[model samples]
Target: MKNVVITGTSRGIGFELAKMFAKNDCRVLALSRNTKPLDDFNHKNITTISVDLSLAEDIKKAVSFVNSNWKKVDILVNNAGKLINKPFTELTSEDFLEVYKINVFAVAELTKNLIPFLQKESHVVTVSSMGGIQGSMKFPGLAAYSSAKGAVITLSELLAEEYKEQQIAFNVLALGAVQTEMLEEAFPGYKAPLSATEMADYIYNFALTGNKFYNGKVLQVSSSTP
Candidate 1:
């Protein structure tokens, strides 16, 4: 069995990923701000750690807890992110900072802390938005969100190169309009081509076996043409 660590397991794609991995008998460490939703699962293999990723201290504590209990991490999914839909003109520096804190900084901080525990041939996948991709379809109100996700892609690429000798694969999944609360919040009254469960299935399989085929790649997943 693999030891999988996933962030943002409170709801949306993260929640589904946790369920999928747990059902597959993976020892799952789920990080989220509120863990009450996960209580309904009641799976012994799934452990929920409640912490605000935006805070460095909280991330340090979470890393300490994981390191104390787990000897090796087979997979780490940096899926915790927030979507703030604000026009470029109205977006404040604080707004950008807030989004980047969760979308980029938190992922970097957590990944850096857990690198020592990652299995030599492990997989690290970060969830980024299609908007993060250069020349992808752009929306009016997602400037901050898109820019932050773009940073995630860059981080994944750089880490992949830096850790190439370690044989740890780093990849970014640039998702497009997954049917989650974040999508609904970003585009009200519009339906997404993919559902959260569908995304979770793809991510689970990718985390399990994708490293064998892909390294330092950004996979754009969508049913519609970008």
Candidate 2:
């Protein structure tokens, strides 16, 4: 079984992806901000690390530790994300930078650091948002989140071209409003607009089987939109 590393596994798609990989007998290395994620089943083949994505030193240490232990990672899933709802006029420079630091910079840096240790035929899946691709006009208070995710897609496109020679596939999953803890954390009292499990399963398959026809793709998914 191949080994996989998934980031942002404290919750949401990262958590589910880690479980899916372990279920298939893959050695799943999961890194999140939380040292012990609440949903962690503590499976034998799954290893969990807690490191802050926004800190370069912490990320370096985490990468060094994983490389030392696992040797080669067959899959890298960038799935940790958050949302902040503030009007543009109310947003600060620090706030904008913080969003990009977690959503784009950290993801790119981790992917770059793991490039040498990634297997020859390994693939990378970037979990982005439809807001990144088409923009989120319906949501007025999400400019920072939307802009950061947009940068993610652009970064993926460039990496897809650059890494194709090494047989490292880069693909983006653009999702529309999955029901995650962050959704509730940021929007309390709001009913979810969609299913998180369905989105997670869709992403699981996308990472496992999508490389066949997806040389470079911005794959989008929504319960309402095809």
| Candidate whose lDDT is highest | 1
lDDT per residue, candidate 1, 1-226, as tens digits?
A: 8999999999999999999999998999999998888878889889988889988888887778777888789999999998789878999999999999999999999999889987677999999988999988888999999999999999999999999999999999999878888988898888888889999999999999999999999999877632
Give the Å error, residue 208, model 1.
0.6
**Candidate 1: residue 59 Cα off by (Å):** 1.1
Candidate 1 TM-score, true structure as reference: 0.97
**TM-score for each model:** 0.97, 0.92
For residues 17-44, what per-residue lDDT tens digits would candidate 2 score against the true structure? 7888888898887888884763458888
Worst 10 residues of 2 by lDDT: 217-226
